[model samples]
Target: MSEGKKMTSSRRLQLKSLMLQIATKRLEEEKKEVAAAKEAYIIENCPPPDLSGDMAALTEFCKKLHIAIDKIDEGRYDIEAKVQKINKEVRDKQQANCFKL
Candidate 1:
């Protein structure tokens, strides 16, 4: 490639890398928000009974919370995987272009 074309390609690659980093950071923040929301949901909707001795009910509440949290985590994991895959693709493309230059 010509010098101008190579410089442009390098700049484009840098932009892609920056964009991917921003997206990854945003996803991480979103995951944290989801976790906080799950915790809040559990607290708000499944308050412990006042019996002070009902271990069974407390355990059941905990179990339900665990299931909900797990589901949220699974969804976040899927999103993260997709972001990572896209990041990898961008990196691969950038590397290939670099080699061509």
Candidate 2:
């Protein structure tokens, strides 16, 4: 892996950790935006169930809620996968260096 200038495992792990944190924060922001959009869309289209008592409006709200929930879930899964992959690399690098010593 080190043909030229070599990076220590500790340095590689630090860089990967920083990258993971940035990615996680970005995903969190996106999730917040999606939640806000969901709220706005629902309020604009649907009203309180007791006040509106409209089936169509309630269904619209439900659909929008599900859409937002799905997006959030997908984002969480993506972030988790990225974390796992990075963690695996860090673990592997640590193990490789440990065995070398």
lDDT of each: 0.91, 0.93
Instruction: State the lDDT of candidate 1 residue by residue for 1-101, as single tens digits.
Output: 65553557889999999999999999999999999999999999988756564889878878877998999999999999999999999999999999999
Candidate 2 — worst ten consecutive residues by lDDT sum? 46-55
Off by over 4 Å in 1: 1-53
Cα-lDDT of candidate 1: 0.91
Report the error of model 1 at residue 91, Å: 0.3
| Candidate 2 off by > 4 Å | 1-53
**Number of backbone collisions per candidate:** 0, 0
Worst 10 residues of 1 by lDDT: 1-10
